[model samples]
Target: MKTGVMLSCLGIGVLGLTACGGAASSALDSYKPATVNTPEDAKRWAKNASAPNVYLSSTAVLGITGLNGQGQAEDTTCPKRNQDGNTLWLEGDCTDSEGRKWVGKARRESEAAGSDTGRFVYEGFGYEGTDTCGGKEIAGKWIFEGVVDVTGTEEEIHFDIDVRTDFTGPDEDADCAVSDESMAWDYTGTVVEDGSSKNTWSGSGRVGSSKIGVATVETKDEVIDMSVCDSEAISGTTTLTGGSDTVVITYDGATDCESSSTVQWSLNGEAKGELTGVSCASAGSAPAWALLAWPAVMLLWRRRSRDVRGGRGRRRI
Candidate 1:
């Protein structure tokens, strides 16, 4: 009887050890790194990393108020304006350079009328009518709010602006597909006169019918010269986090404006590998908001070199 009882205890101990080992193996597998072993993986990482910068520059190009004819939207007419004590309300309609109609309403402090610093809170801003893209009418909306501060002389004016934008649209992937796919983004950033920006953005909803899950982008002192047709970030590092993966991109700050960037990726804090010669230009090419919003908003505040002392049209550094 004694020998039988000892054998039974030994069997229970072995079963427990087997179950524990299996559980540990599964947990380690879950922490495996993302696929970053090829140049293609680097390209994909670069694209996602630079997306926040594109969004930042595009939003700056939209300006504080779309009423500025210098912006992408032109021929703005505000038919209604009401002043109630310290608050001012405005409603207007405008046509973008692409012929798409936009109707928006805003409220600002009445004191901002003649001030160089103020805030404009957009109550409603987006496409007013059928806006077609890729032979199909696309529906989307932009919720934007900004504060603008201008200082210095007109000859050498300086601008500092803070902006927040939220966008929701069909996740057609620029193909004009008919599906329930949709994507949404919430981003906020700041732009200064020197064309340097910092941005933090998060994505939700879906990307082409597949849930984007948890994704975010954070940029640090990113500088871009949009005047250049093939512009990419000239300097700075952008960190992009998606699910269990993290990608870090560092721009070479090449004076020639070449698309020289490096991408390093990791998963769950495990270092995977790194790649060079990654092109960040693709960031502007196909962002989440690329289809209906970003293309029209493609512009940036021209950066002026501090050493160059001349008129507005002079050479930039």
Candidate 2:
């Protein structure tokens, strides 16, 4: 499962650097994926990030650099709502049953509920970096944000999330094989109800790089449904197209409601053959990428919405 095609989206800027370290790093790598600077920082907090918020590819990647992914869980503070019940303020951390940890902070204006109808501005919600993790030299920042509509009824809801995430580095870990690289993605995405048993999701976005040297990604859209699943299980298919190439992942059995899913990865527009792990989990849990990645902001939307309906989205908030 060589699915590390993430470089195409964000970190491709570091591609040349990953190849010729010093020269490129001194020049292009000069841009160390900005941090929380000021209002001016808010102006460019998410600079160079784009995507439709649907696929598992890298938009801010520099190239394909596999590192020891997703780590242990930690406690977090996810907000329930602002003083006004309509405004769902996202500012916290959460560690799932799995050991994946996530921390996040919303921007000023765009950080809360967008409208009364239902809209959530996503922010970079990811893992807190460490100079060393499990004997690995892991240090980097992965953050994402965008607007999403999480308002819906009992069995159905509309999902339109514009996601932009920035992945900085594995910091050339000692224990884990990693490359010192970075990337970003800003794109659009949509999720619709197909029937009571299923839901359809799709999106399109662009990146400057790809593992296969391509630049576009199209999710002909994947279908997810738990019609036959239990409370702790989920099932679905992921149909994603990168540049001219496309791959699909089909969920045959039960998807652990707790974490990731190991599914069939195929390039023939059908999920078959090779086995791969994907990040498709329930709202409260973390996905594979997100397990260790930052900006678990989307969960903010899901959790907040649940809060609106008097559900558990705003647990511990």
Would you give me the overall lDDT of model 1? 0.34
Off by over 4 Å in 1: 1-72, 78-104, 108-116, 131-175, 178-211, 224-230, 259-317
Instruction: Name the top TM-score candidate.
Output: 1
Q: Each candidate's lDDT (Cα)?
A: 0.34, 0.31
Off by over 4 Å in 2: 1-85, 90-117, 122-128, 134-139, 169-237, 248-279, 283-317
Q: Name the lDDT value of residue 282 in candidate 1.
A: 25
Q: Residue-wise lDDT of candidate 2 within 223-305, one digit each (tens)?
A: 55555442211344434443344454454445344233334456544434534223333223211121112222222111111
lDDT of 1 at 239: 61
